[model samples]
Target: MRRDHPMPCPDRHDALAELALGTLAGQERSDVLAHVARCHACALELSELSRITDDLLQLAPAASPPVGFELRVVERVLACSTSAPTGRPRRRKRHRLASWRPAAVAALLAAVVGTGAGLLAASTTAGKAPPAASRPVTLSASLARHGRVFGHVRVSSGRTPWLFVTVDDLTGPGSRTVICEVTLVDGTTAKLGRFRLSQGYGSWGVPLAAPADSLRRALLVGTDGSVLASARI
Candidate 1:
């Protein structure tokens, strides 16, 4: 008789959010799904993430954009990049797993991930997830007294807008009011969006009204006029 070996796996835990939001595909998706079927821990996690994603769906707006609205932002980013100083962006850690799901899911993923139930099951496989486009630009920042964050940029990151930013690894008070901003290469800032990080994980995926390529920095400013984290774009 031949011995049976388990199927190959990868970083399935990191992709639960993507899987719940229907973004993961190919072997990566299948592996996570399969693992969830056999692993009790993963199944519960999948259920929680799925429930969170469904809740955010209610807050999403259904509408179209005005004529030429995107054009203006694109033009601005282009204009600034031409006059901006050149510097290498910080090195980004590449992952074969999905970057993030949708914007709403990203926000929810950030908050709940701090809970004991939101932590993903551990796995050590080298398989890669489906590639969306060219690798996104990633940036990082830290709060003045406490907290740290990283942002991922993708134009096709989600359905709401042309600019998609995935903010992750936020640490600090859960109920802080903060404004996220993106600084253009030309030294002007554009508002990315606002996230009121609740008690839990502080990861958020927000839509910015600007171009990712022209962004030079990302700032998380508190309501009290303190910088939570400053990230290089």
Candidate 2:
């Protein structure tokens, strides 16, 4: 009866996530831990995944379900189910879900497009920089006179050059949009990227147009081209 005891199966990688969530019980939990002990890669992956699970739990607090939430869910489920006419089971998405699919897809597409467009910069002097697939160089930025924005930049020598930059800040508005411009050693500026801030003030990464080590400093510019924030690297 104990799911924490080792199961007969030796390979149950699919259950690792559940194990990390503390939801795998009895033999299932025992098997996963046993496997993790012998497999370094799986153990490492389980540790990494647990961090994300912890982060998400912090972001989304536990709350009571909405009124009639269970009833609505049941109605939706029942409306989509039908008796198997020939004793064959059928699993298909119902038409009721169609109304929201297009809108959701469109919203996702628009965000991606907007993010890409905002990161585009003028032609680079570093010979298109790099594709940002390699190890990164650390950089820093400041918000004019506000505070510091620590960053990391990664650029690889590829045809389409770009910088993958991650920023850090402890104090700022949680939700806002701003442009990043990196001033290069040659006194020319590169479009580092634009970012829409969210609940987290730091640890935001975006693509830019310059190489990792080429910038003298980075500026977070406002709509009117005023430097509101900054980082130096």
Error of 2 at 177 (Å): 1.1
**Collision pairs in model 1:** 110-201, 110-203, 114-201, 143-228
Clashes of each: 4, 19
Tens-digit lDDT track of model 1 for 1-233: 33143322345667888999999999989888878898766677778779999999989998865322243233333334443436532222222224333343334333322211111111111232332344444332332233333544443322222333333445555566566666656666655545555442233343332333445666777777677667564
True-vs-predicted CA distance for residue 23, candidate 1, Å: 37
Candidate 2 residue 36 C-alpha distance from true site, Å:
32
Q: Kindly report which residue stretches of model 1 are placed more than 4 angstroms away from their true locations once superposed.
A: 1-174
